[model samples]
Target chain A: MDINWQFIISTLPLYQKAAWITIKLGFWGTLLSLVIGLVCSIILYFRIKVLKELVEIYVELSRNTPLLIQLFFLYFGLTKLGITMSETTCAIIGLAFLGGSYMSEAFRSGIEAVSKTQIESGLSIGLSQMQLIRYVILPQAFAVTMPSLAANCIFLFKETSIVGAIAIAELMHVTQDVIGMYYQTFESLFMLVAAYLIIILPLSFLLTWLERKVRYAEFGN
Target chain B: MQNLGINVLFEGTTLQRLFEGLMMTAGIAFISIIIGSFLGIGMGLLRTSKSRIVQFICRLYLEVFRIIPILVWLFIVYFGVTNALDIHLDGEVVAVIVFSLWGAAEMGDIVRGALESLPKHQVESGKAIGLSFWGLYRYVLIPQAVRRMLPGAINLSTRMVKTTSLVVMIGVIDVVKVGQQIIERSIIKVPTASFWVYGLIFILYFIICYPLSKLSKKLEAKWEN
Candidate 1:
C-alpha cells in the first residue's frame, strides 16, 4: 500500500491538539508525582509511626497494579459511589498514583546512600538540623536521585498513553480515532510513533545530560 | 434503581467469563516470557560480543523499545503493518509478538548486566584451565549467570504480566475487556456494576502480580549474601 501523505497532512491539526493534551497530562502528572514522592519518602525515611505503614501499603498497591486498571477503577469505579471526577483528573491521578511509588523508592535509596558520616560531620561543624539538611544532606541525596528521577519521568510520560482508554484524547486515543474513521491505519500509526519519538527521545537525552551535570564531586569518574 | 454492590460479580456467566479472560492474559504473558527469555539470552550474549557493530545493533534494538510506548507498538503491528502487508493477524498473536519483542529487550539488558557483573577473574581462571571460549561460557559463565539472572528475570516477568493488560486495547478479550463487557451489559440493572467489575479486576491483577514481586524480593534478599 502506498503511504498517504495527504491524509497525514489533513490529520495534522487533530494530531497537534491531541499531542498538546498528552503534554498537559504528562506535565501535571509528573509534577504531582514528584510532590507525592518527596512527601512520602520523607515520611518513610523518618519512620513516621502509623503514616509510615500507610505509605508503604499505598506504594505497594500502586506499584503492583497496571495503570490501565487503576484508571478504570478511578474513572469508572468511583463514579458509582458518587465520587465523580473529570477524565483529565482521573488520568492525572492514575499517573501520579503509579509514579509516586517508583519515585519514592528512588528518593529513599538516594537518601539511604548519603552515609551517616556526612550527617554527623555536618552536625559536628555546629550546623543546626535544618541547616545540615539544607547544606549537606540535600545536595548529596539530590545528586544520587537524579538518574532514577529522570527514568521515572520518562516512564510516567509513556504511561500517559493508557489514559486514552478513559476517553481522554491523548496521542494513542486520537490515533485510534483516525484509524477507525478513515482506515488509514498505517499513516495514523506512523504519526503516533513519530509523536512519541519526538517527545521522549529529546527528554531522554536532556535527562541524561542533566544527570551527568549533577553528579556529586565525590562520585568520581 | 436496584443497588447491586459486590453482588454484581456473581451475575450469570460473569465469573466464568472473567476466569477465561484471566487465563488468556496469563497464557499470553507465559508464552511471551518463555520465548522472550530464549531470545533475550541470545541478544544478551551478543551484547557482550567483542565486535563493535554487533554491540551497536543490539543497543539500537534495545533503545527503540525503550523509547516508544508498548501501546504504540501494538497499534503499529496490529493495525498498521498488517493492513500495509495485507495480512490478517489475530489480535492475541499481535500482542504476543509485540510483547515478546519488548520482553526480550528488557531481559537482554538484565542478562547482559548479570553476565558482565561476574568478576574478570572468573574468565581468566577459565582461560587458564585450557577451556575454550564456548567451554568457558557453558561450564563456568552461564551457570553463575543463571543465579544472578533469576531475581531480575522474575521481576521482568511481573512487569510483562502487568503490561499485558494493554493488549485489551488491540481487541484481545483479556480480563479488563471482559469486565468492560460485563459492565456494559449490566449497567441498567446494576448502575454500579462498573465499580464492582473494575474493582475485582484490580484485585485480580494484584493477586497475580503481588506474589511474583514478593518472591522476586525474597530471592534478591536470599541471594545477596
Candidate 2:
C-alpha cells in the first residue's frame, strides 16, 4: 500500500487534540474509581456487614455485565429517567463505575496480600485501629497493588475511547469525525492508532517503573 | 406470547428468540477461540522469540491490545476498518474478528506464562536427544506446555463468550440486543412492565457466564493434580 505521507501528517493535529480528551477522561475516571474502590475495599475488609454486603452485590453485578450495557443503562436509561448531563460526564461516570468494580477486586486482593498477623500485631501494640491501618496495613497493601493498579489505569485509558459511541469528542470519536470529513479513512485511522500508542505506551512504562520501585521499597511477599 | 406454566422461556417465537440468541452467542465465541488460539500461539511464540526485534514487536502488540479497552477494539473493527473499506460486514463476522484480536493478545500472554513456567531441563533434554526443533516442540515440549495452557485458555474462552454481548453496540442482535429489543417492544405489548424482560436477559447472561467460570476453575484444579 502506498503511504500518503501528507494526509497522515495533516490528520495528526486532529488526533493530537483528541488524545488530550482521552487522557482527560482517563484521569478523571481513574481518580473517581480510586476513591470509590478504596472506600469499598476498606468497608469490605473491615467485615462491616451491611456495607460489605452492598459492596459485594455491587461488584458482582457490575463485573458480570458488559461495560457497554452499564454505559447504556447509565447514559440512555438514566436520561429517560430525567437524569441529564453532558457526554463527558456520562463517559466518566460509566468508566469510573466499571473500573471501580475491577479496582475493588484488586484492592481486596492487595489487602489480603497484607498478612493478618501484621495487622493483629499493630492492634496489639495499643494503637488505635485508624493509626494501625494508616501506619502499617495500607502502605504494604498499596505497594503490593501497584502493578495491577497500573494495569487497570491503562484499561480505563482505552475504555475512555468507547465514549465515542455516545458521541463524546474523545480520541476515537474525533478520529472518526475527521475520517468522515476528509474521507481519507486509512490515513485518519492509522493516525488514530499512532495517537493512542503515544499516550498509552508512556503510561505503561511509567507504571512498570512505579511497580519496580514499589516492590523494591516494600519487598513483596 | 403465550405463557405455558411459569413463563416458559422455550415457547413459540420466544423459544425461537432464546435459541437464536444462544446460538449466536456460542457461535461468535467458538469462532473467536478457534481464530484467536492460532493467532495467540503465533503471538506467544513471537513474544518468546530470541530475536530482540521480534520480542520488541510482540511486546508492542501485547501492550496495545492489553491496555486498549475491548469496546474500543470492537468499535475499531466494527467501525474503523469497515468504514475505511466502505464495505458493510456482517455483525457476527465482525464480532468474531474483533474478539479474536482481543482474545489472541490475552491468550498469547497465557501461553507465554506457560512456556516460562516450564523447567529448563525439559527443553535441554529434548535438544540433547537429537530431535529437531520442530520435532522437539511437536513431540515433547508442546505436549506438556499445552497441558499447562489449557486451564487458562478455558478461563479466557468463557470471557470471550460473555464478551460477544458487547457486539450488540454495533447492532449484532445478540442476546443482549434481543433483550433490549424485547424490552423496548414490551412497553407497548405489556405496558404494565418492561424491566422484567431486561431482568430476564440479565439472568440468562449470568446463567451462561457463571457456569463457564466455574468450569474454568474446575479445570484449573483438576489439571493442577
Candidate 3:
C-alpha cells in the first residue's frame, strides 16, 4: 500500500493538539504525584502510626495492579456508585495516584540515604523538627532522589497514553481518531511514534544531564 | 450487599470465561517473555560491542522501544503494520509481538546493566586464563550475570503480565475485556456490576502479581546481601 504523506502532513494540527493534551496531563500528573509522594514518604519515614500502614497498602495496591485497571476502576467503577467525573479528571487523578505510589518508594529511599548524623547535627544546632526537615534533609533527599523521580516522570508520561483507552483524546487516542478518519494507519501511527520520540528522546538526555548535576552538587563538586 | 449487586463472576460460565481470559493473559505474557529474553540478550551483548556504530544502533533500538508506550506500539503493529502488509494476524499473536518488543527493550537494559556493573578484572581474568569469548561468557560472565538478571527479569515478567491488560484495547478478549463484557451485559440487572467485575479482576491480578513482586524484592535483597 502506498503511504499518504500528504494526509499525515495535513493532520499535523490534530497531532499537535493531542500532544499538548498529553503533555498537560503528564505535567499536572507529575506535580500532583510529587506532592502526594513527598507527603507519603515523610509519613512513612517517621513511621507515623496508623497513617503509615494505610500508605503502605495504597502503595502496594497501586504498584501491583495495572494502570489500565486502575483507570478503568475509577472511570467505570466509580460511575456505578453515582459519582461521575469527566474523563480528563479521572485520567489525571488515576495517573497521579499511580505515579505517587512509585514516587513514594523513590522518595523513601532518598530520605533514608540522608545520613543520621546530618539530622542529629541539625537538631543540635537548635533547628526545629520542621526546620530541620526543610533546611537540612529535604535538599539532600531531593538530590538523591532526582534521578529516580526523573525516571518516574518519564514512565508517567508514557502512561498518559493509557488515557486514550478511556477516550480522553490524548496523543494515542488522537492517532486512533486520525487513523479512523483517513484509514491511513501506517502514516498516522508512524507520525504518532515520531511525535513521542521527539518529546521523550531529548527529555531523557536533559534528565540525565540534570541528574549528573545533582550528583555533582551532592558530592560538593 | 444485595443492594450492591450479584457477583457476576460466580455465575455460571462467567467465571469460566474470566479464567479463559486470565489464561490468555498468562499465555501471552509467558511467550512474550521468552521471545524477549532471546532478543534482549542478543541486544545487550551487542550493546557492549567494541564498535561505536553497532553500539549506537542497539542503543537507538532500545531507546525507541523504551520511550514509546506499549499501547502505541500495539496499535502500530496490530492496526498499522497488519493493514499495510495486508496480513491477518490473531489478536493474541499481535499481543505477543507487541509485548515482546517492550519486554526485549526492558530486558536489554537490565542485561546491559548487569554486565556493565561487573568489575573489569573479571573479564581480564577470563582473558588471562586463555578462555575464548564463548567460554568466557559461558563459564564466567553469564553465571554471575544470571543472578543479577533474575530479579529484573522476573520483575519484567510481572510487569508484562500487568501490561497485557492493554491488549484489550486492541480487541483481545483478555480478562479486562471479558470483565467489560460482563459489566455491559449485567448493567440492567446490577447497576453496580462494574464494581464487582472490575474488583474481581483487580484481585485476580493482585493474586498473580503481588507474589511475583514479593519474589523480586526477596531476590533483590538476597543479591544485595
Q: Highest TM-score: which candidate? A: 1
- Mind giving the per-residue lDDT tens digits that candidate 1 earns over A1-221? 78999999999999999988988998899899989998898888779999999999998898889999999999998998899999999899999999999989888888888889898989999998779867887688889999899999999989999999999999999998988999888889889988998889888998999999888544632
Candidate with more favorable, higher DockQ: 1 or 2: 1
Instruction: Show model 1 residue runs off by greater than 4 Å.
Output: A126-129, A217-221, B1-4
Number of the top-ranking candidate, with lDDT as the measure: 1
Those runs of model 3 whose alpha carbons end farther than 4 Å from true positions after fitting are B1-4
Question: What does the lDDT come to for candidate 2?
Answer: 0.77
TM-score of 1: 0.97
The residue-level lDDT of candidate 1 at B127 comes to 98
State TM-scores per candidate.
Answer: 0.97, 0.82, 0.96
Candidate-wise lDDT, in order: 0.91, 0.77, 0.89
**lDDT at position B28, candidate 2:** 90
Comparing candidate 1 with candidate 2, which one achieves the higher TM-score?
A: 1
Off by over 4 Å in 2: A1-17, A81-86, A180-182, B1-19, B67-88, B125-151, B169-171, B179-200, B217-225
State the DockQ of every prediction: 0.85, 0.27, 0.80
Docking class for candidate 3 = medium
Deviation from native of the Cα of residue B149 in model 1, angstroms: 1.9
